[model samples]
Target: MPYTTSPVLPPGTLRRSPQPVLATGDGLVLRPWRIEDAPAVHAAFQDPLMHQWHLMASGSEAEAVGWVERWLTEWEGERIAQWTVADAHSGQLLGRVALRDIVLADGLAKIGYWTTAAARGRGVAVRATATLTRWAFDAIGFHRLELLHAGANEASCRVATKAGFALEGVKRSAFHHPDGWHDMHLHARVHGE
Candidate 1:
């Protein structure tokens, strides 16, 4: 069967350009990554959990700078929109979130996020994810958004659940981590879901 656009939009619509900031109130905001964020980003990537699930580890400030540069290029190309999740009160870097693999003509995208060790268990990832999820649906006109995490990542699975994404089952041997191929727990929320 052929795929079709949702009733809300015509067959070929591009996503809206990402805004400068997505404020989550109570002192957290999702903003564009800055060159100056390289150091903080480098440190966060050093966390043991980050390397466990994220696969790649930044070996130096230069590698972190390259990370930020890639995101800048992604934004320019409209393939991804990455944001620095930060504290509004202290401007501390909490983590990162992104809407990647956006297929605008089909009105769907994927969401990914992680939080610093200090911000873990504090709902920063959940709130940032929720904010981006709403923006992707309501403002960007996406019909569906997905969040997939390694099955071993209980913390991220919890975040996806808390952010209201319904568990859609696992994809066996779906991702390659440092350890080996791992199953991925896929979760999703459609428009109005």
Candidate 2:
């Protein structure tokens, strides 16, 4: 239970769930992470913008492998649902998307995403966000979804809006990165919205 005014959640509010591979009609494929993807994931993290915004960088294949292992642990612990965004036909890694901070009892989750340098400006993040948002709402019956990004991240702001999440407002100094504290923009989409 969320210990809030929200309705009591049904039984099985928290349990291990399968990370099924979801495919879109086009070429997008959302699937679980694998160790072999370490090099590619490492390459993507080499992007300066990704490292700056996320405050996470994989300098070695081992570190990237560890990152995937941690994500698998988070999934097994039922705390986060993450997927490696790839091309369905080509199977090339494009990015990653996640529904983290999952409060299943309250039917709410927050989304985060990043795209590889080659995939940016090509609608990859927007499409991935929309697909996951639809899955969260339709398949899981989640009532609300949120997207948050540093206020200075114009690209993320655009992706949030394109995914049908309205800009809620800014949270002052909500994130602390190596650079400094950053203001964050909060965007949200309700079930009926």
lDDT of each: 0.87, 0.86
Which regions of candidate 1 deviate over 4 angstroms?
1-18
lDDT of 1 at 127: 94
Candidate 2, 1-193: lDDT as tens digits:
4565754334344343577777766789888898888899999988888878988878898999999988876776656888999998888999999999987778888999999999989889998899898887887788999999999989999999888999999999999987999999999999878
Worst 10 residues of 2 by lDDT: 7-16
Q: Which runs in model 2 stand beyond 4 Å of their true positions?
A: 1-17
TM per model?
Answer: 0.91, 0.92
